[model samples]
Target: MPNLSTTYLGVPLKSPLVVAASSISSHVDRVQMAESAGAGALVIRSLFEEQIQLDSMQLDEFLAAGSDSFSEATSFFPKIEHGGSKEHLMWVEKTRKAVSMPIFASLNAVSPGAWVTYAKQLARTGVNGLEVNLYSVPTDMGKSGSDIEKALYEVIESIKAEVALPVAVKLSPYYTSPANVIKQLEQHGAGAVVLFNRFLQPDIDPDTETLVNEMVLSNPAELRVPLRWAALLYGRTRLDLAVNTGVHTGRDAIKALLAGATVVQVASTLLQNGIPYLSTMLLDIQNWMDERGYKSLDDFRGKVSQKHCDDPFAFERAQYVKLLSSIH
Candidate 1:
């Protein structure tokens, strides 16, 4: 049997396959099942700052509407009990008590203050680490790329200064230079970088011509983006790389490791195949490692990375001009 143990964000994991933040953490039973199914670690469902802000605003509106009776009735059980930050903190505490595996609490905030504040609260939950789901869509015409990047760094720095737990940033791939962004995050004390958060894109309904929110699961092809970036940044940085988005099987996890990823996070696969499938993926990876005579993860990890590969130019290309000219 091969040793599948690995370390992520300085925390020891029994395996490199982690259950990414998804609907899995909604219940304690499911989280325990994932642990038994061979997941090294689990990221709890994210606490969205937008959700907290909306709840706060609604509570204030009710209080100011002269509905003293209603407000008094809801006072015993504050808005925090309904959908505020307190609920998430309580849930994290409960989950931590239920499992011995590393449980990382996730926070998705848009503002620097919100990020720092929530990070501190989450740290008090006794979680092993924190994952910052930096969910931002740069739609404003007045905002430049540098402006958006500055906001990201500020939030990271603020959280780092306030929290004691290890912090990992789940980044979006739409940046002009992802490597540069990762470097900036590391400088701000990020322990790990989760490559390419999958964004929910809106679709239009042909009949009504209205936009609809779609929840489409990622495909295996989506792994390529993170793979390339992970390979490109392998030897250049000291920060741990966590490949996410579209990872479906154990072989996919192996591919990520070969590209120099410290760990591979999977959500769509477990959701589609059920949590027990984690065991199967782990078995597949072990089998592959044994067949290749690789005793440990480091044996074959980064073997195919841009830094180790013969042709580094494949990772950095311009228009495929050479390939097109050769084809004709």
Candidate 2:
């Protein structure tokens, strides 16, 4: 067997295949299964700002439901203040205790205050690191791309100021200049960046004339974007690159490593197939390494990236032009 141990966000992992944040973490058994199946790390599902707000609203409604019926009705309930984040925090702490593998907490928030506040709370959960899920759809026509990027930096800066844990930013792929953005994130104290947060776009049901907000899992074909970015950024920046969004198999993970990704975060494959499938993916990587006489992941990592590859232009537009020209 070959060595698969690697470090991600300064934390040592037994394998490079990490389990991405998803509903899989909602179940403690599934999380433990992932750890047993050879996942490098597990990012717990995000504590979304909306969830917190909704929880608070529900609590208020419960407290005021029959308060006006009588003076003692208000006193019938205890004056305990509750927030959804607290439940999520307890869950994270519990998950951290249940597994020995690195447990990463994820947060998705809009405002800088929310980011910093919850980031501080999550940091106290004894998790190995934090993954800031920067997931948002820009609906403001007046907001420039620079404006959005600035907000992201401000949120990250605020969180870094309040939290001491290693922070990894899960970035959206819609940025005009991704390399510069990753460089700026590193400058702002991000330890790693998960390439390309998959956006769940809503679809319209033509027959029913209704908008359908269904869950659509990612396919293997979605790996190209992050693979290209990883190859382009391999030797250019100090930030650890975690290729996300489309990794589905061991070959996909190998491609990510070849492109210099520090780790590959997977969620769709496990959800679609099964959690135990993680072991299969890891086995495939180990077998491939053994057959090639590669002793460790570092031996082949980034070997085909743009920085060291024989055909550098394969990752550039020249290759696309060549492919188009070769059509006849």
Candidate 3:
């Protein structure tokens, strides 16, 4: 059997397959199952800024609802706050204690202060690292690309200053200069950059005239986008690059490694196929390595990247023209 060990964000992973942040940590039993199933590590479901804000507003509404009708009615109910980030922090702490494998806490905060505060608090949970989910919908037309990027830089800077844990920024693929954005993050002490976050799109119901938001699992076809970027940016940056989205099987994990990813983060597959399926993917990679006479992951990692591949243009617009002409 080939050695499957790989280092991600300065942390040594027994394997290169990590469970991406999702509802997987909602149950401690599921997390333990993933560890047993051969997951390199698991990121706890993100503590979102919007969710914290919504919770605060709801608490205010509940506290003020019956204050006018009957002052005593408000007193009868405890002034305790519920649905806040306190539960999330406590849950992360609990999850950290439950699993012996490396566990990273995911955080998504809106304000700079909140980013620093929450990141610091999450670090205190005794987790291995932090995945700063810079997940947001940039709808402001007035905001220039530079302005938006500056805000992201500030968030990274703030978190780095307050948190001692290894920080990996989970970036949105919407940036005009994704490479430049990553360069700044690297300069700001980012341990790793998860290639691209899969931001959910809201769809409108034609008849009902309302937005319907739902969970949609990624398919193998979606791997191309991150694969190209990972290949293109390979050898160009020092920061560890993690591939996320579209990693459904062992072959899919191989594709990411070939494209120069330090590791691959998978979520949808485990959701659709169960956590134990991770062992199947790892087996596939190992079998393929053995067949090829490769001793370890590094033997063929980035073997097909732009820096090492014969046809570098295959990852860029040059291939688009070639592909179009060949189709007809």
Best-to-worst ranking by lDDT:
2, 3, 1
lDDT of 1 by residue, 123-152 (tens): 999999999998778889999999998888
How accurate locally is residue 194 in candidate 2, as Cα lDDT from 0 to 100? 98
Q: Which portions of model 2 miss their true places by more than 4 Å?
A: 68-72, 326-328
| Better-scoring candidate (TM-score), 1 or 3 | 3
Runs in model 3 with CA error above 4 Å?
none
Model 2, span 1-328: residue lDDT tens: 8999999999999999999999999999999999999999999999999988988888888778768777798878778586568889999999999999999999998767888889999999999999999889999999999999999999888888888899999999889999999999999999999998999999999999999999999999999999999999999999999999889999999999999999999999999999999999999999999999999999999998999989888888848777888997
- Off-target runs (Cα >4 Å) in candidate 1 are 60-83, 322-328
**TM-score, cand. 3:** 0.97
Candidate with the larger lDDT of 1 and 3: 3
Q: Using TM-score as the measure, what is the rank order of every candidate, best first?
A: 3, 2, 1
Measured on C-alpha atoms, candidate 3 has an lDDT of 0.90
lDDT of 3 at 325: 86
